[model samples]
Target: MLSEKSMELSRKIIILIYGRAFSFILSLIIPLVLTRLLVKDDYGSYQQLIMIYAIVQAILLFGMPQSLLYYFPRKEISDRSLLIKQTWSILAISGLLVITLFGITSQTMESIFPDHHLQPFIFLLGIYIGIMLSVMPLQNLLILEDKETTAMWSMICFTVIDIIILPSAAWYNPTTLGMVHGIILTSIIKFVIVIFYIYKNYLSKLETRESYYQEQLAYGIPVGLTAMIYVININIDKYMVGLFFSSSVFAVYYLGSLWAPMFGWITQSASQVVIPRMSKAHNNNDLLQIRELYANSVEKLAFIFLPATVLLALIAKPLILTLFTDNYEDTVPIFSIYLLLLPTYALNLGWILMASGQTKFLLRLAMFMSIINIILSYGFLTTLEGDNRLLGIPFATVAVTWISTIVVMYKSLNTLESTLSESYHWKKMVTIGAISALSAIPIIALLSLELENKIFLISSIVIYGITFLFTSFKFNILNDNEINLVKSFLPFKN
Candidate 1:
């Protein structure tokens, strides 16, 4: 039975990863094509629109999704339907607040942009905010409920729709608003599908009541606050950038941020399932399952993040060139600095902190993190005028970010010992890190030889990646289950 459970867990993890890979590929293709098709100014407006959407999304969900992700995974969900209804109630309240604030601030936002009357567009976006609020937490339920195949396939199918429709919209009339229209239309379609799936597959049978709503609110609010704080920590940098930098420079920073920070999604996806899975694992007083989950999550990321960040730093030029037209030179160095976050974020999840049932404390700790990020960003963007100095702002901010996260994580690690193994996985990870770094020697050599074109850079990257994977898997550095999880995707490996 234990073997079967492990197998099931492993299988689910693989399916989720594969689904994300498919979605990610299509995601890349659409963005890459659109970036090429749209001019810098058009792309800049589109990106700004996205930033506005992100902020709106954050507030619209009323942080209910974070609460859902936190508690829904537990085996002790005595009244699932009631909890779900309560979450929806919270969402309703929060969504209204966000829209109201947007109303008051709409004109000021347009003034800041200096080129667009964001009010109409923000209003268009406001209508869907409630729908979006449901979808994200519903996604949380799908993953927690182990509806992997449904969720995975659904996302891929949506991306396929996006891939076809978005570029078509651009081709017919490649204006900035046209592109935005295409994206919204596509997202609305996906949202409809998700709502349908969530109800049909999971939420339909749950009972709803007032008591459960109150109980979940009592528990979920702290988790939601933690989520908001974490978001504040991460998004605050971008917010500061928009304030202090030129619109053009803000555009460059936005584009460069496209890759490195979102790479943390690798961690996010695994932890999305991991949190619920770990929460369900009988870690009440025992540490084995918790340790297994934490160590495995951390270790898997080491292989992913270390080289990617280093290589991203090396390949920023080609990446930006390949993804965007060569209208901008600022993204490369700025992205190189931003790429430093790859390793730091990969190592610890806010979920690990969640799994230990320290939501309030984590929220407190996140306050410190947000404080640090704000102060550093202010220093770089304003006090020191680092944004004007090209990559200097990102560089300074990245340094501060890494230091702060490391200090906080190390402090958090001791508490996680209940969930993480006593083993020195970090040490083993370092050894693998060494091997991965060694594999990159060739790429460094190529760089020195001034092989600057896209092909050489991309080819060198492929070589280094293969070399690193070979080194890690050939020895016992990655055990059978870890290797098999990766292999499950490959036709031959199966």
Candidate 2:
């Protein structure tokens, strides 16, 4: 299984698995720690600022680095120097443009949204943008060259920095501003490490690859634009929520929305490997291999995500109650609602569109959905805001995701054989999930009775996991390859 091609892909997948799992652990732990150390308003304020930070970082990326990832792997090592230079040039220009725009609208940007505490918001988020620009080149190299160890280590450095800074900074006055400063320092340290690696390992011996640069830009721009618009389309609600509702309400929704990326992150890292592999499959004109890969991806996705959806549905209240303070319990329903879309993420056919050069159609679909999403979220969140309508955002979010999934499925089916059993595997997974979900509810109800949070969460997770495993095994939903794929990642296998 670990041939040159398979070996490279497998190593990258392992790296991505490590990265995704560690990042998820970091997110869960950091928020839990900070939630304890900080006041509700302070944590809420910090969450709001990160929302803006996410969009700004997206701007710095501007879809350029990903383009670099696609074409970089195709070029010769001799031309790498020029490729590195041109890629940086593109990033530099885009970064400057983003900074310039920020400079002009800094005050408006800060005042435009009062979701967070007003003091030094621009500086706080500026650090995030800088981190994005400074990290992108290294990130590209990691994916294209399949340097998992280096990439994971680089991220580990930042996670360690964050772990140290959070508690220490809390002792040093623990304000939202202090939290921001700690984050900035961590990003700076990480950016330095990434730059050192890129220069020593990649940039120092770089040869020019201008032709590939242009090709990359052409392929990457549309996808990046699609991503940018998709970002707005997806989270435009958070941006607009501040306009229409209270910062505190946005805070509740924000806490709920934090659950959004957990499943997406898992799928995303897998897609990083799968996209390049699938692209190679296309290049080789291996239809059989390509079809098998797609089907296997779906199966693996269901294996991972089906349980998440069921678990989240069963235990959002306990999970939040245990991990966060009492202030966040109200947002529990939003997490439950968000879990409804977990499968869409694990069923990651959309990445196929972006990676396979169908980004324009994807972009169009994104724009149409964004408009619909913004409308639904604004329409609903406005009505529900003060009256405990926190569920509105997730409802709208799930709607958009399911719609996008359906559209993508249709498009993907068009690319396959007419007699293909594309829906059969999906149907089986859903059927098994329905049974798993049903069995989990009694446990969920029992756990809900205790409200003590931690114990209930632990018990719920254990029962739900065992139940899911039994159901999956019984239904034959997991074939040999999928089971083996999972076993390879676990710590110890029988």
lDDT per model, in order?
0.66, 0.68
Which candidate's TM-score is highest? Answer: 2
| TM-score, cand. 2 vs. native | 0.87
TM per model? 0.86, 0.87
Error of 2 at 470 (Å): 3.8
Question: Per-residue alpha-carbon lDDT of model 1 for 382-477, expressed as tens digits?
Answer: 555434544555665576567766655665567655322453377767877788778878787787776657776678879888888778777667
Model 1 pairs whose backbones collide: 290-419, 291-419, 291-420
Those runs of model 2 whose alpha carbons end farther than 4 Å from true positions after fitting are 1-15, 107-119, 208-212, 382-388, 416-424, 438-451, 478-494
Scanning candidate 2 in windows of ten residues, the lowest lDDT window is 1-10
